[model samples]
Target: MTLALAGGALAQDAQKGGTLRIVGTADLDHFDPTSGALVTTNNFLRATQRTLISYHASTDEEERIRPVGDLATEVPQPTNGGLTYTFHLREGAMWNTPGGARQITSTDFERGVKRMCNPALGSAMLTYFVSLIDGMDTFCDGFAEVEPTVEAMKAYIEENDISGITQPDDLTVDITLSETAGDFIYMVSLPTSAPAPIEVLDYMPDGPEYRENFIASGPYTPVDYVPDASLTLARNPAWSAEADPLRAANVDNIEITFGIQPDAAIQQLQAGDADMVYDITIPPAILSLLTATADDKVMTMSAGRTAFLFINTVSDNNGGALKDLRVRQALNYAIDKTALVQQMGGPAMAQPQSGIFGAGVLGYHDFDLYPSEGDAGDPEKARALLAEAGYPDGITLKMPYRNQNNQPEIAQTIQAAMAEAGITLELTPVTASDYYSKFMTNPRNTEEGAWDIAPVGWAPDWVGGAARSVFQPQFTFDGRHQTYNYTDYNNPEANEVAKQAINATTPEEAARLWAQVDELVMADAPVVPYYSEQVVLYRGPAVENFQPYALGGQGDWTNVWLNR
Candidate 1:
């Protein structure tokens, strides 16, 4: 399991073995791989967990997202007409067990997949698996009927099996998908697919008890984690460089400090007090200053992310007006996209989006269903639509925004534009960590009409040829809403087209169908898509072998070496 190093800074002789400090604002969503939802979570888990397949930590934009063998000895080609993936696990990929070093095997992956529908904080990326893997839905349905306690969850896991997955031997894993998916390799590369040890079955998924008894399959083992405060990861005795090709494990220890503002974090980086950021993006003002100074430390990378106002079509607010197509279109017409882009640090960092797909995502194409003057928006068009929808005077709507990275300002911008179109907005602010977990992703909130529209953002689950990653999780393909679908909006036409796009034999055919799905989804106006986001990052002077992680939208933490 060896490959040539390919990061932009890997050419330099890396002075290995030092403590690399990481600073950030928000705490990690999950310490466990099966439950990780955020890109930052993926970044953090890379140090402590090993997936079946993984992308290299490279500065090359395209190469960084390409999947290669990690815990698996080699990336396998599909057999049985592309529905079968047989992973050959590497021998030396060991877990830091209390008993001693223990080799991870096929059963660990089986347990990991079974834990997805745990009645406790279950896997947010469960949608990716249940639909693709054969009999997974049945397993999840059966598991859901069990009690939420750790004992019950573990009992059910032990008693049942997912029929799609099988263990031929200790080191061999066989996964049978119901349908052939071309990008299944990339899907396996995600943290959600990482193998879970038997010890984890004793605790609830991602509970404090599980975090305390953290195990490691990668170069580092997480320890001393305090939610929203700090964490420290020390070298894992069980891990060896030969077992995995993706991470260098140059840093002997990794220290993480939380609750630091982005502006202050950037300054700390320049002073060599920190190596990288954990979760927050650099402030636009600070990024501008760094860019103007021609700082090589500054990195501007393309993120397969989109920022938008997610409309609650399920809400009964304004007399269930959001469900009306005319009202939803009015909401889109009333948004000043140029203002939104400027708040996101101008066109250099973001572009006004007109469709569901983000810029650089596989199926993305230029299309404007609601064309506005200079992207400044059309208040007249909105008002006309509002009148047509029976809101003669105006409609009042609630908007909640995450309190991080210029979002409050962006929300204000949304409020001002909506005002011009006879729509009044009531604003609510939420902490970044709780924004999704407590408020938005909870379908009950939308059903209760707690929020009419909310500022939301999304990065694809995987990078290349990932239209399915973007569209599938966030949209309703069947009657059921997946993880990221905030409003639970459904369209039968869009669902059928999405199936076609994902199953298409060629990239050309897939893109064409995905493009059609995008139009069908937008025509319903479930969300007022604003901009495709590009993140600007700054690393500390001591951070060497730095690479732009397209998913994390920051420098690679697991692979980079410390220079100081």
Candidate 2:
């Protein structure tokens, strides 16, 4: 097995000191690491955030997903029946502070976890910690009652304590989990678990004041940030290449300009006006043009991102038809995934998916329960299933899709296909930024039938052995904070198996258990899995070392330097 951050620098000439321009249409969901849920946010944070363990910008498949030390000295092994973990802060993982660049302490790490449960703009992934950490749920429940004001939040954090997290010394951080989890290290690798400086408590989490007084624990510090418009990054003087292994800090500065269309953004890159893309994938036409010309700058890679449609079981639309497994299965069988694939930029860019786990993910295996000839849906079978489910007169569903990229076209394709089987779709196009924050993650939207179905995408939170990343967050529900589990789907039997997989002794054992959970989840038919997508990334002429990072589905910001 390969170690994470093994020679973190990409294989490129040691060229340095140039501005890398990033163009996109969406602003970051949140500036604070704790609240960041988007892949683009993680990519940007790789430049300025430090977690206990982090992924390296390595090209090797095995090395890229491995967890490596960042703020922590190393990836620590668990003791006490895999329930307890102790990690020491490294020598020079410093935070850009008011007084000076101070070494981040274990106290900062503990504070970061404490801030994860803050009622105001806290982490969407807080359930991962609250469910695993021994006393975190109790702390979060009490904190939820406090005023959302900075003083109240700050006082609660300082006054209360989580028995699961402790600081033995200024540098040593210890954690006690409720159960053994083989993939626990990958959870901490998330940007949400990064250490937070004490200065952040003065402002609402990720508010204007917090962004203005932003601190840096990684290579770059953000400045001059205008919401959905532009942001600038400057090299942090405190960042030492000798002290850090995950990022090389090759560029002197970064300028992110939002609101650029995909076509215009790619044109800028071709014209050498921009060095990289920010939020959008390359337009299919542009990808074709570049690939036809055998352009060296154009590269297609897999980042384990899969697109699917989540069925609203909680919705009462059409007399709650979606709550029936047969109706969901009918929707699955009726979707012409082949047409969906063509709309996704052809066979080269996407492959039809039929199960909960996307292709190449840890638990993924080829299995389409609703088999169709030529992979082209069976409308007759779908009509029969709908009739059996008491929707013989046909049913209508409201579906929302992100307006950005080719989703609008995909939504139309789905509408046209399902129409053949007596399923009427009233499609609603949504803003990319608001699609998750305002719609899908809101359980009320599901209950109120605001949207009975939606096309959504998922990329692993951390890559290697990340079955939980795909399943636990997006599928299972424990009645905690409603998050990626948009459909209110819950299977206690499968969830228990997930717990068993998490505690499995070996990779093979865990993978076997994960596969079982995948099969079980599909039997319930909560989501209509569509296609596993291939990423098309275009780098500017001046961009160098544009290595593919699995987590971000784009070039690694920590590795890319500018030849210009």
Candidate 3:
């Protein structure tokens, strides 16, 4: 869907040579592309790094999303029964180096994949590639056994190579997958798959040294960066506009300042102090004012992001109350998604979601297993189920939620609704940074019954055919646990269907199988899917040609030029 703008469009021509200033509430979790999973980090990486394939940063909705080649000459067609892919690197693609610029080769691409398996790095997206690439799982397992040091990491990479990837020449790279993946090309577009220079192997991935001494292979290079402070991007002298088709590089420089709240960032944008708020959703309170005053600058776009509450089925909180399916179903029925939507700033900000997959993702359908009345929830039915599950006198549940954004407000709304169904929710507020990394994902926290339910959100790693993006990471647990699979849930029936869907020849068939998987998961009720959110981005008057990318869920920094 197109971003809904409040005012008239700006001048069409892209004017060059100005510094684009950006402000945001949170700092990037990591600058190392392989280790970071957050969208903000991806936005930062898009400016300073190039992937083999990338989405075009276009003003047109459809053309903007179609994946195109960046470092490669073009999107490769699959060979060898859809199990192999061959990529031809662009002729003039170069990496910014200390001496000068050096040609980026197929070896750099292989190095990028190997970095993903670094144990100390803890790449969240590794699970997506491990099984898909032949011998990758074995590589990761071996890497895990080694000491987490630069010497060990370097030796590991030098000794072994992924059996599936072969660099026939400096420009040609071939990849073979363990199974057929129709959307495998989409995975290469992600930041995790971006090429890394061999020089970076000397420094630990995701460590302080790597973050500071980062090299660039994209249109822009990071000239300066501070962990929680600010970052400055300047044009890469070695980068050729002809080799890359995705980014326009209209702006001469980009300045991103972190730790600015949404309200403050909006004020800066209105006062002409900032060009845009990088990846920060406008607060609902200010969204109304902007809609009336400067509608054209306000952007409300559909993002493939879903907000849900994970029920701790494995945790023995409240004497294993959540272990009962009736109780889990009761929790689902008790949440008033309609009220939750209102609290999150009306229909413009979010739509009530019934399943794990949000709209725009493949396999997403309008089917609610709980069948609430107008999505307002059925508290009476929930109480009956609770009673059936041996909680006739009601139950108490501990919930932890991020303090930032509208999560606190949403939690309060859920608390009010659950109370009506004889469930009292104890809310514990946590900072946005520590919420997921420190508290929710910690196994000790789960074992000690620290929380019974927690507010969480997920966005597909890439844009198209997102069945594996949603299911494998969040639902099914094969041999290893996925980072976002907070509940440690597994269903054999759903897993079997997901495997079939992954191997489906056509998009239509995959979508059908994914829809069935959604039905099965919703029936199990491991998590309460509440709302699919829309991102609201505010741009200053000077910001021109502000087109939002689906993967970044924010305006493309490379395309927009400062008119001022």
The 0-to-1 C-alpha lDDT of every candidate, in the order given, reads 0.85, 0.85, 0.85
Off by over 4 Å in 1: 1-4, 8-12, 477-481
Worst 10 residues of 3 by lDDT: 2-11
TM-scores for all predictions: 0.97, 0.96, 0.95
Show the colliding residue pairs in model 2: none
Model 2 lDDT-worst window of ten? 1-10
List residue ranges in candidate 2 displaced over 4 A: 1-12
Expressed as tens digits, the lDDT of each residue in 1-564 for candidate 2 is 433233354344657787889999888888899999998888888888888998767556677777888887799999998899999888888899988899989989989999998988878778678879889989989988999999999999989999999999999999999888888888999999998999999999999899999999999999678887899999987778878877878888899999898889989998998999988877777777888899998777666788888888887887787889999999988999999888867899999998877766777888888889978899999999999999897789999999887788889999998999999999998888899987887778888989988999888888787888888888777776457888657899999998888888888888788888988988888888889888778888987767777677778887778776
C-alpha RMSD (angstroms) for model 2: 2.5
- Model 1, global lDDT: 0.85
Better of 1 and 2 by TM-score: 1
lDDT for 332 in candidate 2 is 89
- Candidate 1 lDDT, tens digit per residue, 1-564? 343467645334776788999998888877888888988887778888998987776678879777788888888999999999999999888999989899999999888888877877777778788889999999998887898988888899999999999999999999999998888888888888888899999987887888888988888988777778999999999998888777788888889998998888888888988878887777778777887899998777776789888888886777899889999999999999999888877789899999999877777899999999989999999999999989989899999988886777889999999999999999999999999878887879989999998988888887788888877778774555566788666778887888887779888998889899899999888899988888777788887778766656677777788776
Error of 2 at 17 (Å): 1.6
